[model samples]
Target: MKLSKKQARLRRATKFRAKHAEKGVERLCVYKSSQHIYVQLISACGTKTLASASSIKEKNGGNVVAAKKIGTEIAKAAKAVKVTKVAFDRSGFKYHGRVKALAEAARDGGLDF
Candidate 1:
């Protein structure tokens, strides 16, 4: 059976998540859409979200700049909750363009992922 693009991405994501789960650290999960990007800091056990940010609040959602803003905001929210380190979970998206920008900005904001 041939997998659709979305299915294939999910397969990859599931595998990656399994590996991350083994590490037992909090995760910074990213999800992107045509109009917005969302991020959440999830507990190691995956039962709760510690912090979250999204581009919906920004003036522009579909740009790299907005993603960077969301990333920085998420990092601040995480720090407020006393979380400094986390595993980056790109949700099957490649680590480039907006995704890369967000990750880099998060790092600059003192997130140790």
Candidate 2:
């Protein structure tokens, strides 16, 4: 079977999601598109969103700088909700470039993952 790029990425994502689901820990999920990046802190049970951040208003939301900003924003939002730990779900995106910047910024902002 030949899988498209998005389908392959989604297949990879399912493996991580399954593990996180079983553990029932809060998850910080990230998704990026050509025009924007979005993040969400999902509850342990996965039924609710605890916090969210994005780069919709940034001048160039697809860049690393914007991703880093969104990361810190999400961390601050988590702190306000009193959550310090979470599982990072990169949604099958390679952990480099913008995604890497976001994760590092989140760590710097005091999120433990």
Candidate 3:
């Protein structure tokens, strides 16, 4: 069966999750929409999310600036929860625009990806 755009992205995302799980590293997963962006820090076992952040909380997660702030927020929250390094799972989205901005922001905020 054929998949829609979001479904295809999910399918590819499952593979990335599996790889990260195999490595037993926490993963920083990002999900973006037209008006919002979400990020989650997943445990090494892929069993739970350690932390999460999004632009929705700030009412402006759609742009690069908002993406960066959300990234920093997630990173700080992860550190508070004792998480350090993490694999970056872009959820099949290309590494540019908001996604790239968020990732860069996370890195600058002290996350190793």
Candidate 4:
């Protein structure tokens, strides 16, 4: 079966989610919109959001610079919650541009991907 680009990505994402579920580890899911980035640490039990960051105005900054800002925020927030290791979930988006920048910033901020 042929899948459109977006559908293919979603299909790919489903696999990652399944593995993450089985591993039972906190997950760092990244969502990148054309103008914004969002990240969340979902609990292993799948019952709560451990931490999150985004391009929300209160956080400001939405470009590559802004993505970096959110990355830092997510790292700090995760640390505050005592989370050090997490699986990086790219949601099947290609790892470049904003996504890459955010991951790098998160690494710089002390989150092990």
> lDDT for model 2, on a 0 to 1 scale?
0.95
Model 3 CA lDDT for position 22: 78
Q: Per-model C-alpha lDDT, please?
A: 0.92, 0.95, 0.90, 0.88
Structure candidate 4, residue pairs in collision? 61-66
**lDDT winner:** 2
What TM-score does each of the candidates earn? 0.96, 0.97, 0.91, 0.92
Reference-based lDDT, residue 72, model 2: 94
RMSDs, each prediction?
0.8, 0.7, 1.5, 1.7
| Residue-pair clashes per candidate | 0, 0, 0, 1
Would you list the rank order by TM-score, best first? 2, 1, 4, 3
TM-score attained by model 2? 0.97
Give the winner by TM-score: 2 or 4: 2
Give the per-residue lDDT of model 4 (tens digit) for 1-113.
88899999998988999988988789999997776788999998778999988897844455788888888999999999999888999999999888889899999999897
Total colliding residue pairs, candidate 4:
1
Q: In terms of TM-score, how similar is model 3 to the real structure?
A: 0.91
**Could you tell me the lDDT of residue 93 within candidate 4?**
95
